[model samples]
Target chain A: MAYSPAVQELMEALRCLPGVGPKSAQRMTFSLLQHDRSAAGRLARALQTAADSVGECRLCRNLTEADLCPLCASGRRDPGLLCVVENPSDVQALEDATDYGGLYFVLKGRLSPLDGIGPGELGLESLEARLAAGEVGEIILAVSPTVEGEATAQYIAGMAADAGVDIARIAHGVPLGGDLDYVDAGTLSHAFAGRARYR
Target chain B: MAYSPAVQELMEALRCLPGVGPKSAQRMTFSLLQHDRSAAGRLARALQTAADSVGECRLCRNLTEADLCPLCASGRRDPGLLCVVENPSDVQALEDATDYGGLYFVLKGRLSPLDGIGPGELGLESLEARLAAGEVGEIILAVSPTVEGEATAQYIAGMAADAGVDIARIAHGVPLGGDLDYVDAGTLSHAFAGRARYR
Candidate 1:
């Protein structure tokens, strides 16, 4: 017998995960069947649990199980410093550096008009509101170094300037076109520490 | 605020998918938030749907949505020719070739004594029964060239020898220490076409 339709369907579904193509999906599906039925079940359950339970933090747009993310709720974090990023993964990269005690503001996307993503789509209104509230003293732009990322940073910097907030952007230690996820934690941390003020 | 707890949990859960490390998982989680609320929901549904519906074929241990996989039920496939493989992925690889017209027997796993996998665990009894019934005239060994895979193929050959069935094994066009999943489809098809008889 060849692969069952159910198994094929499962393999196709597994391919939806990032970096998992058709072949890898098939290998993973069979491996799960051969060795760890429980792990496969857990993975399915986790996908559902995550999709159903997770939502953007009301404040920073970071992933969270609760209504308020830990960074937002925690009094110990430096609430005065706000680190703006393009995606949640960037936040993880920044946290790994352990240099910044500040909370994060995830843009969730960059300003790509061609792809139909604009400031409103990226929740810039919420960012503006957060800056107006005066709860944040320093704003650090920690987005990627891509052209779209640079454009988004410039747009946000202009907004921050109008708002009269102490605005800064992360240092450019990472190469152009590099993903924050691919950079080493040490270099990322150093970049965070040596951030320069945005002009 | 940093990512919310719910988002964090979802990202963590997504990491279980094949090749989805911590960084990619986080990126996917955030990227999904950008526009795929419905796609995410559909993905969650598909994961559970496939897991619950798929099971091993009773005949070959291949993945199936029904009692038997499509290849087993299809009258067009040559039941007289049985191709034995270590995993269901191998079946897909062969199917993609569109050259062979034989039925398949999926061992679902290889023999690894260290891992406590033996012949009985591989369902050799059913294979022997298929051959003894005289329904199968040719048995093609499509197992991999790895140490465990070779051992499993040799064991199958011995079993086929006792049954007095014509036997052939896939040749080693695959690079040593290379995975079949990584090989190109054309190479795999060529390898399949040029398979030699294993004594």
Candidate 2:
């Protein structure tokens, strides 16, 4: 038998989540209905609020409720050092792990020609405008190490060159605490080529 | 740095779901904000609608927008055969796998003394009322194989005996397609003890 219209709607809506499938959506729907009505209400209000209010920061393209994201607006960050990444989550990851006092520019996606994502789709003209303002002296490419990420980094590096800003890609190597024997051959060779000299 | 108030609230609300922790909540919040604003809005409206409208069925205590659940209200089901299950999901599972044209009564929980769950909390009084109406001739206990489930099954069996109705517990044995070696000793012993005569 089919679920009630409201339950079916809730289950269908839950399928919009990143990893949730039909079975998980069904389970989540029943779970919310059976228990935690107050929490369910709060979740509803939160979803509405976030959906209606959250938008991209005009300067960095990171998610924010204001014209400029907190990172871009903060005076403590170094305006001359700009880090470019693929998504807003990447900004959070960098903030959590590093003490870098620099601003960030979120691309919101990588260059995927098959999916129709390109330079213009990523709002690169706005990024070019920011770089042309002459405040950012160094542009750090902190995108992923995938092939698309590499191509996107290269394209951004060319843009940085045109803007006369020093560009650097984040280092990729065997992760810390990862065994050299377990590392892939391509990564091992890359790490060897970029090896540092002993102090 | 802290997330914006809207994002933070969404994350906190997502944490209310079962099995969702802080990290998953954060990821879900960002995913909804970045990839699917329309879906997020739909989920919000669904949550509010479901929470506001859905209520327990008056006859069987299963979730329903109407006074009676579909199973109870349907004329095709056998009113003489009643299946007692611990949760509404169990009813769905039975309907999916078995062609038992019987109606169902959802307990919403089992007998867990440590958690203060008892007969009253499980709405056994309503179950007894249904039994007393004399339409039900056989009762099938479909609770889980946990200790609490066992106690609940036995309690229901005693009630059925007092009401002069036939009662049967669903069989517990090795699951279909499971390797014998992989089956636990308790299940193995139960299967051995309940062996049937060859036809």
Candidate 3:
């Protein structure tokens, strides 16, 4: 009663995606069998095409099919104001906000000392080189406010300080619509430290 | 700033998978830039291979990589008892149970007149032809107990009756662990109709 080897292998391969588990894998495998064979074909093709063709932009470290990512290649963007993020996904999220018009530097990972992931592993040497180019006037640290994220930001801040670049971290405090009572202790403390002066 | 044409096209293509939206497509596309390029390549190859190689089994109509599916070709199974199901995945589920040693016939669909699906669309004639071959003895109707499923079973039953083959529909009653109090009206009525003789 075991499934054919091919089907089982396909299910296993599909389980690699984030949030996909055994049950979801089974459901997806079954769906591929039931309908939309073309979509399944698309998934397979996308996986291979992205792998083969897509690479990081040498300037911005964002994903691109060419040597430079679109954000970096576009002459319209402000290269002088670079935002540093832990992952490329963060770049997309920031884009959805529609507030920034600057270049980006993706770490592709965070500084996890316990997991043996250090600054060198996250392409810090390239950041130093970018800083030394003297074209960047300001750097906005857009890493998340989590412990690992904070550590990485502090590390980058120290590096930027030595490079004589103006360093600014993204705000970490109360959310716009969040109730004061519901705010967590760490966030409340940050809110207090980052309180804006009233006229 | 607008994404480069390559980045934008690949992102849109990645969104074709089930549950993958524009946001996820972007994230996945971005991650592909960081993780092994070969994984994406493998996914694309798997898609094409599955699409091009996998097709319906000639005998049972279940999905297969060969002319005859693994189940049909296996020498260990009983060819005389065929379990008729509505989809290839159902065959997989039944196989997973590892109890039934019989053959299978996948209908690919049920009789849904509302949705323009009918017996002719599900290869009822091919099923009759298989029965006329006189190799099958007991034909088990393993369809779900929904209205459409019941109607399909009835239609197949009439055909089997004309062919002089012994037809048996799987019994429908209260689910094994279901509570009588919470059972729906339709299920309650079906349970009454399919009741067994009390000792």
Candidate 4:
């Protein structure tokens, strides 16, 4: 059906969001027009303001309006311990789920040479410079277990070894409260091989 | 975790969208800021323009930026075959799913006196005036079949009877291609009661 130019343009622009297709964009357009004009205006202003001002934190590559992110700026977090993750969302996930009181180093993406994402794109040189400055006592690798993630983690581990800093990885295993029958064979085998002695 | 003021505000504002929660809001915000700044600007402009300009169609109460929506303004559709529906979205759904080439009168909502919705809210007076003008040959009730919907249909049918216009309700039953075992008993009973003769 042909909508008015304004409505049609709104629907088309809404599709730029991930997972939003034509149907969903139509629904969103009608919902905003019918229910909340104030909310629509607010969202528009917010999008414009954030797109203009938000940038990567200078220290960790996490998204922030200031030079450093709130987590990086906070004096409460330990500077001696650092956690490496692939995306800003991953940093948020780890912060919410874990009690680790260390700083984070966001890689932005894993090492994918075929995709043209190399050490430069991931800001690895900045990370190496920070490592060589000799303040960090331990480094934690929290990247995913995919092939690219493994390569990225090993490269960071090598840097840590050269800097004479301790390095450890987050565990890979069956999740707590997960049914063993539903676990995949590869994960099960990996868990079995890395089994620890009972308490 | 505390995000920078701009980032946090963007995430919060994104939750105004239907079905978007905190995690989804965060993802949308980051995606717009990081990957598609141009899309974010376009979306913001579109939202502001639509919200500032769009209003209901004078004849059908469907959303439009002009005096009438594209369908209502078109001379091709049969004005004598007006289909009554609950929302602009329903009009869209019918247009996509059926070959119905007719004008529409959008009720916008069903009758629900308990929640303070009545004929005045649904623009039924305008609908009645059109019926009295003696142009529409049939009134098709495409409202849902819930208790409120049934009450709404009955009220409109009463108006049709007084105006000497033919009235019919859309069929309710087990959906096409649906398994009989999976059909709810209420739908089955309704379908059985409304069965038609076969050739």
> Which candidate number would show the highest lDDT if scored against the true structure?
4
lDDT of 1 by residue, B1-199 (tens): 3455456666776665567787787767766655566566666665666667777777777877688788887889888899998877778788887589988998978999999988889898899888888888889998877789989989888888888889998666767887999998876887789777899
Q: Which runs of model 4 end up more than 4 angstroms from their true locations?
A: none
Clash pairs of candidate 4? none
lDDT of 4 by residue, B1-199 (tens): 6588888888998888888898789888878988999999999999999999999899999999999999999889999888889988899889888888988988878999998999999999999999999999999889999998899899999999999999988889989999999999999999999999998
True-contact fraction per candidate equals 0.62, 0.66, 0.43, 0.77
lDDT per residue, candidate 3, A1-199, as tens digits?
4455566677776666666687777677767656778778766765666676776788877777788887788788888899999877778778888689888998888899999999888889899999999999899999988889989998999889989999998888999999999999999998999999898
Candidate 1 CA-lDDT value: 0.78
Model 3 residue B199 distance off true place after TM-score fit, in angstroms:
5.9
Task: Count clashing residue pairs per candidate.
Answer: 13, 0, 5, 0
Q: For residues A33-77, could you state the per-residue lDDT of candidate 1 as single tens digits?
A: 656666666656655666677776788887776777787788788
> Which residue segments of model 1 deviate by more than 4 Å?
A145-147, A173-199, B1-3, B145-151, B172-199
**lDDT at B62, model 1:** 80
Interface RMS deviation of candidate 3? 2.5
Poorest stretch of ten by lDDT in candidate 4 chain B = B1-10
Instruction: Assess every candidate by TM-score.
Output: 0.79, 0.95, 0.92, 0.94
lDDT (10s digit) by residue, model 3, range B1-199 = 4465566766777665667788777766666556646556655665666677777778888777778888888878898898999977778777787588989999988999999998888888888999999888889999988889989999989988888889887777788899999999988898998788899
DockQ class, candidate 2: medium
Compute the DockQ of candidate 2: 0.71
Tens digit of per-residue lDDT, candidate 4, span A26-123: 98998899999999999999988888888899999999989999999998999999999998888888888999999999998999999999999999
Error of 1 at A24 (Å): 1.6
Task: Arrange candidates, best lDDT first.
Answer: 4, 2, 3, 1
DockQ-superior candidate, 1 or 4: 4
Candidate 2 residue-wise lDDT, B10-109, digit = tens: 9889988777887888889888998789999999999999999999889888888888877888889999999999888888889999999989988999
